[model samples]
Target: MPELYSMQFLLFLAAVLICYYAAEKLFPRFQWVILLCASLFFYTWAGLPYVVFLLAVSAACYRASHIFAEPGVSAENKKRVMVGVLLLHFLILGLFKYTGLFRRWSGWVIPLGLSYYTFQSVSYLLDTYNGKQEAAGSFWKYLLFLSWFPQLLQGPINRFGAMAPQFFRSRKFDSRLFRKGLMRYGYGVLKKYAVANMLAATVSHIFTQVDGDISGCVVVFGILVYSFQQYTDFSGGIDMVMGVSELFGIEMSENFRQPYFAVSLADFWRRWHISLGAWMKDYVFYPLALSKPMRKWTQHLRRKFGMQWSRSLPAGAANIAVFFLVGLWHGADLHFLVWGLFNGLVIAVSDCMAPLYRKVNLPKKGAGIRLFRTLRTFIIVNIGWYFDAITDVRDSFICLRNTFTRFRASAFAGDILIYQIPYRRENYMIAAVALLIVFVVSLLQERGVDVREGLLKKPAVLRLCLYLFCALLVLMAFPFAAEAGGFMYANF
Candidate 1:
């Protein structure tokens, strides 16, 4: 399979674009055919067998949704079909993605985008069942929605209602939109290859350090770098995917919003992986929160304790359940489970302490308060990255122990730290400069500035120079053979 960041994928994308636009001009009515074909080719090129799985999912979902919209189907039967379709979708997802948790072989290769597309399938069925939208006009259009190539691998998790119409609508070529797409694509390239790939070298080495060989400062610094690597890679991939969609005049959901600037754990999640959060809230959290069992439980709490515990307890319990499923969705591993629970616990504790925070009466508008909140959130988030960075669940505890007990200033010195990193001093300089650039851009964005639009207004030559500099930095930071790997979340 060709890596998405590789030159080969670029060549493939170029070919697809030429064919796509030409088809749009000559056979306008069949534009969707071109898109469906391109999407299938892209998926098949990655893994031929997975294409069958993709089709099966799309077919099942389309049929189930169609059944729901049938004129004479009884409401009870429609509900049964909805529930059955959801279970079948989830069962396939679990078989492929969670076999590691259930069996000993542990060598099954999960299908790409199974989690993403399955969620999309669930949404399609539920929306049809609830009358949010009619059943798709045709299976082909529904299939195209499930298999759109750009966001297929790692997603903003496109919605059927929002995206399906865009796929079939007639669009003329627009120079401004194309230019914006190019710029977004360039920015994603810089973030992925220049910043995240470079940081991965140091972060990987530090996490692999054995017991008695690590320092407190090293652990903290390593986890900090891991946090940066994760955000850059995931957000960068989304940028590229969304940029391609923009070129086609399709606007994908925004996935990241400068999460590190967020003031609390809940706020951090809202900013990070916004689509997944939205999905869980709509499909998992809200439904569970309002379900009969949960309502009954809340009422019981109110009777046993009081209104205070009643309100917070039920919501907190629902949050724990949502995040546990969230973690399991990432992978059926103990580390991921712990990562999910850790986040849920933090959010629950914050809820319980909300009254105390209100009583403190901290100034809400001051820079000092904002800075303190940002740092507090950042620290908490970095601590959670330990579980994510370590695949062996037991190693996480040892890593945390070293982070607190083995303090050493030497970890900051050139010889000690640089020796552990796979990259050279010069590469570190490149990463540092790239990070500074991203930090400045993120700061402007946090304040509601459109950095891309600002760049569009700059002199042509200045913009060209900046683009060239970023491309060069990415080239310089390209990983060696031993360090090469795909995006972190590709496993999901």
Candidate 2:
């Protein structure tokens, strides 16, 4: 089985870092060359056949963009060029990644990372056509951006306008940068092994073993634990990626903030998977909002129900459609579509009720108000996450029904404990402790405390001890085998 921290992978990263730092110090102009070579090596390490496909796609888009950018190109011609490039990329993506759906047409194994980089490449082509950014003069720089090792498999889905400038900026290997990067990486390791992994084991055990005979209360507990497991697993992977990028003085986008603290579904989307949300807003919502049909509809609504109703209905409908698309993008499955639509509906319903909510005049400042809002937000977010965790629409419906069934003493009985398949008393204890730590840390961060900085301010011995403890936990707890599990967003 493949391992997350294989010795060969570590050796590869070490060699790349050494060469990268050396190149930065010696021939700064050739740093892009070093990055390109390292990226190719990284991609090849996944599989040599896949590397050929990656290069071919990169070369095709790079050349197509140049054609679109030529002098005196008519507006219609430019549009055609842009559309052609995008379609070609999508076609290649479908050929490799979606071949299973069309197995009779073409039998081919989908390459890893193709879904991620395909979107990145299409975004690059679109941005260049829209005049948001210039096409890279060299193919190598474009290639490096597409296959950057830290973001290849799982992505924050970067755009050229945001990431290209940093790729060109020369980086110097400094002690401060190294220290900060290592700390971030270490923090991610602790979050994954010490917290997320343990929760995963427990959730897996409960979900698999809970029979139809289980009582409502025990099922609710299992669902709650599953919610936390998914959150930490996905967010912990983001931390690892972000931390590794920092090591080379390259910063990727931040994907999550304090999402669970959000008071509304709209606010939750703003804080969670921020990159995907931003992409949908820019590419889908804005265009639809400004389209002629929507504008006419807005005018018609204004005539029928005064100005206020007219102003919101058009944009509100657009948001719902965009979020529906957002869900479909995660997978071809109907369950994912329902999950996305559920969020979109929540946002829509909340918007409709805003005037009533405002009239209720809830206090906004005191500790009591803050505590109430925090708890309310946590409950709502967890319910949404529960829908996301279930296997299908029917299962989600049954789970919800079971949750609301009448409580009973037998629901919490010892037999319920026996039904937890792979779970142990030790696993539960460890997961509970890990969750407490996560909650405390999140609370500190939500209050605007910089956790790493605060830790640094402690006495040297204390700080060292904390660091060592985190390292030991990771080494002891990480599931090292490939069969263990993968980052949640990888399937997307």
Candidate 3:
């Protein structure tokens, strides 16, 4: 299969653009036919076998949607239909996806984007059942929505209602939008090839030394670099995906913000994977938090301990439950479960301690305090990364121990040399420079600056010079691995 950044995929994207616009000009009303064909082809390019699963999921969801929309359907029947379809969906997903425990025995090739599409289909069903929107009228259009190529590998998990018009309607190509799309694609390339891949080499080298006599500074450096590697790779993939969707004038829910600047674990999650978090908020968190049992618990607490405890404790419990599922959503591994619980416990404790925080007065609104919180959250997040990036639970703790106890910063250079990590000063310089660029851009964005839009407002000569420089930097990361690697989130 072609990686997103591969030359073959680029050529494929170019051909799609040419054909898509030509189709729009000629058969405008049916331009979507070309898109549907392209999506089908792109998906099958991954593997022909994967198409069977995609078709099955699409068909099941399509049929279920119609059943749900039927007039005079009783409440009990609607619920049965929902539960039956969901059970089947979860069964299929679990068999293929949650096979980490039995991966040696299981030969299931879980379809790409199974979780994304399944969650999206569930959202559609729930929305229809709750009268959020009517069920989609056309099966082909619905299938297109589910199988749209850009987000098929990783996704923002779109809604049918928001996307129906974009999928089915006729539209003209906009040169401006296309240019912006290309620019966004360039940014993604710079992030992945230039920075993330470079960092990946060092991170891999450091983690592989966990069993060796690596020092605390080396482990700390490895985990910190891993954090940036993960963010850039995942967010860069999303950027490229969004850029491609822009060529077709389809907008998805934005997946990330500047998560590193987050002031708390809760705030970090809110910024990172914004769509999945939104999904949990709507489907899991709200439902659990507002459930009858929680309501009764709240009443009991209110009568015994008063208002503050009543409000915060239930929400904290809901947070822990939601994050437990979030961790399980990643995989069936013990490490992932522990990672989720760590986050859940932090958020739960913070929530439950809100009243005490209010009682302790300081310069809460000061810039220094804000920076402190951001750095503190960042450190906490990096600690969590040990569980996530390192697979073995014991190794994760060992790395944690080494991070604090075995403090020798001088071993960093020797470890880097011993690992033969990229073995080039120029490579390290290039990656460092690229990261500096990212930091400046992110800082501006944190202050509400639209860096891309600002660049667009510059004079033609200035914009040309900047674009050329950025493109050259990307080219320097050349001889990029052709196998479609670096997207860390694709596994999920």
Candidate 4:
């Protein structure tokens, strides 16, 4: 797949934008058709054979939802249709996601974006069946929703209700929106190429080092870099994707919300991958929490414990189940499973502790308190990255063990650490500066400041200089393998 930030893909996107706007102006009623065509073309480029699969899934969903939408459809029939649709989605997901987990299917490659699109399909089907949304009136509009090029591969996985109308409606060009989108796009490119990719050179080298060869400090340093690398790459990809969506006058949901600033594991999840978390809460957690067995469990807990403890029980269990699925969604591997459960358990504990937190009346507003909480959450999140970064389950634990036992502050001093890595001192300096920029922006965002809008208000020369700097970073890193490999989440 062509990297979204690459020159080739940008050229393709430019052509699509020009044609899309032309279609809107010249053939107003059929602008949706242009988007549909563009989306399919983009998907075909990404995975040609899978375009048929996408169409099949979209067609099935379109037909099923429409059938369910017909007046006088029995509730039982609607439920069955919903179940069958969900089963089909899970079946495809299982085939691709778990194919390599077993020895019999080691040769299979998971289709690109199967997890993302499948979830999207499931959400749309559920919405239609439950009457929360009407089925798309046209197959083309629905197809465009499923395969929209900007977010087709890695998504802020959209909903039919949120996006379909935008495709059907005509939108005039807005220069201000266009500039904001471009600025956001540039910021994403800067994060991906300049920061994330730069760190990748050192991170990959450190991660692959033999356990015996690296000290605790080295392991800790590697874990920290891995955290930043992940944030930049995954969130950066969303930034670019959302920016593209914005250019088309379609607002995609925000996926990240200064996740690093979260005060607790649950808050961290709320801020990170915000869309996926919302999906799971809406579809998985709510349903599971309200299930008969879970309700009974909650009542039993209420009898044993107090109301506060009992109320969170069902949701806590649902959270665990959701995280397990979240882990499996990432990959069919033991490490991911453990990673998922670890997050679920942490969040559940937090849920159970909510009452105590209120009783203690911890300071909620002071900077000192906020800083402590943020750092605590950051450390907890870094610990979880060990499971995510290490593909081999056993090796991940060993590395974790070594981090505490063999740590040496001297690892940061000289040739033993920084000098031995592939990245030079200058690269590290650049990364530091980039991270500083990210931190400042995140801090501003956390305080409800609009950094982009603020930048736009500055003098024209200042804005031009900043844009040029971002562009330079992107141009310098574009062709470098270490700086611009395919996005990390794109693997899913």
Candidate 5:
């Protein structure tokens, strides 16, 4: 079963497509049933052991929300009930996802999709309490939302308001939507299995090589490659999930939007892992901003630090805290924590300098300025990527050192594959071509244009030729060895 993961995914997806269409055509009212059943089966495929826990969590939230909806429940009573529900959900999440880290003696096994579903359940509860969305009248509908197969692994984290109506609506299967969805899914597959996986393999070799034996130059190169590998792997997974959901006539929120082209760290956050950042802002940042402490702090700063300082200071501090939490959310490791804080600091410092940066004399609407800023931002992001790629802080520093220092001719005299890993002409060629393609696509996207749409609008012969070329490139570049590996973000 472990050896056949890819085969299993293909089979599951085929079964889902057939069932979805059949249900839509035959018994429109049973659409939610089909989704729920498909989702359960997807979870069960991971193993039967965790199915009980999944259902239990769903039931807990289902019942708790009903308590909130009861006609005579006092406002205080309702708040208490909702708090209890949130706590129970978090307790289960901690027990399953963080028991090992929290309790050293315990050897608990965390269940699959616990993090993803927990967030979904909590979001639904919060939405219901806030009256932004209604509680699912039926347990099955709620369960389906929690366990939707396409988003079960990693997510765009659909809100109740976003997903519930779609789940209940009857979808008339359309060929164009299916074709576009399939193309998107195929593009993601190529990005992951072909581009990111190949890069991952190379990065793994570099990281495993003896530390000091490799020149700092090689280490720097590895860090840069790892940045691309991580982004492609994560965003590629999101593309696949969104594409799969689109086949069912549901549009998942896009998780990425040409983040590398962002002019500022704040803009990058808006573009990358968009759902997560939005979630933090909606649930965490807003609440913090409106709190008594923050309000008071803002007022104090206004009087003492001047109006400009008051407006920026509170938000800057909050941004730092959010980034710190974001870092800690990735892993228990310090490196991830530092990576999160590093981004937070970037945004905070950028916010402080916004006024001065705007005043700098520069070209406003020229290709030269755009190119320079793009390059500058890319370099800053790559440097930040060191914290994420290297497990050890010292190793990251060493890579930075090697990147800056010029090496002698003797450094290139060794077994190039071990020291200078990307020594092969083919390796350089592939990296260069992959980067060129990504840059072109990003440029198109940044200009508010769709690459696919633009290409399709061309003359028939040109469009066909372009598609055929992409198909051939993907086929030729596919990393067969990594076929069994699921996307990197799937674990998250």
Candidate 6:
């Protein structure tokens, strides 16, 4: 596969862009065919076998979607069909993604973006069955939506309803839109190569050490740096994806929103990975919360414990269930499950404590309280990162215990500060500066300033200089960046 940042990827993108625009000019109504062709070719880069597997998935879902539109089919039968189709595909996902449980042979490959496209396929099935949208009339077009290159890896999981209109409409290229996309893509590349890659080495080094090899202070520092590294890696990739889609006159859902500024666990989730949260809420949480068993549970709690239990407890249970799935979505690993449950329990506890919070607050709307909540939430989120960053379920707890129980500056300096990497000091400086730029940009966005639009208003000479300076910084930083295999979420 062509790496997103590689020279080959640039060449491939250039070819696609040239053809895409030419198609719009000559064959306006069918311009999307160019994109469809590009998508298939891009997926083919992963391997011919993967393409065959993808075809099977797309064909199955495309065929199943028609069952929803079948004349005189009972709703129950449609529901059964949806369940059967979903289970078979999810079972495939499990067999590949969680091979240890199923005893797959050594050296089998998981198809690229299997989990992401699967979710999109399931959403298409559900939406069609519910009469939320008409079934896709063509198999190839539906395949294009699943295989769209920008979202083929980690995705915001675009909905068919949201994507179909933007994709099918004829769109003449706009220079301004293209420039904005180019700028955002540059920003994303800079973030990945300069900031996230720089920190990734030290973060991995610290976590992979035996508990005795590192001090609690170093563990805390590693996890703290990891928080920044993860955000930049993930949101940067999404930025790149959104920017690429924008180049084709397409708009995707915003996946991140200055998640660090969030004031609560629920708020953090709302701001972070917004697409996945929305998906789970729409497809899983709402369904389970509104299900008959949950309704009965709520009524029983209402009789026993008042309205608080009736409302909060049922919703809390659904949240837990949703997050349990969310954890599994990342991987079928124990640590991921723990990470998800940790988040769910915190939210559930907060929900149950809502009345007490309402009564005890001194000044809920105060800036000081707001800042405190944001910091508190940040701390809470970092605690969960232990499970996420560590591979072993037991090691996560060991690291957490060390963090609180064994912290010391002297030991950290001796054990971790002396850690070796190529250009470690220089990489640290570059990462710091790069992170500051990202923070400022995020701050401006938070303040409702469209940074790209603001840049467009500047003289061409000034904007060109800024872009050149960014390029220079990334070139300098990336050469020395260590252990940056690729975007972090691609591991999923």
Choose the strongest candidate by lDDT: 6
Backbone clash count, each prediction separately: 0, 0, 1, 0, 1, 0
Angstrom error at residue 488, model 2: 1.9
Q: Show the colliding residue pairs in model 2.
A: none
- Cα deviation in Å at residue 203, candidate 4? 2.4
Q: Mind giving the per-residue lDDT tens digits that candidate 6 earns over 73-127? A: 8889988888888887888888888777454564557778887888888888888
lDDT of 3 by residue, 209-273 (tens): 67746678878878888998888888888888988898888887788889999999999999999
lDDT of each: 0.83, 0.73, 0.83, 0.81, 0.74, 0.86
- Ordered from best to worst lDDT, the candidate numbers read 6, 1, 3, 4, 5, 2
What TM-score against the true fold does each predicted structure earn? 0.95, 0.92, 0.95, 0.94, 0.90, 0.96
Which ranges in model 1 have alpha carbons more than 4 Å from their true place? Answer: 100-108, 411-419, 479-482
lDDT of 2 by residue, 270-303 (tens): 8888887887788788889889999999889999
Which portions of model 2 show Cα errors greater than 4 Å? 1-3, 95-99, 102-109, 205-214, 406-410, 413-415, 478-483
Candidate 2, poorest ten consecutive residues by summed lDDT: 476-485
Tens digit of per-residue lDDT, candidate 5, span 342-379: 88888878877878877997777788887787677877
Clashing pairs in 6: none
Decide which is better by lDDT, 5 or 6.
Answer: 6
Error of 4 at 491 (Å): 3.2
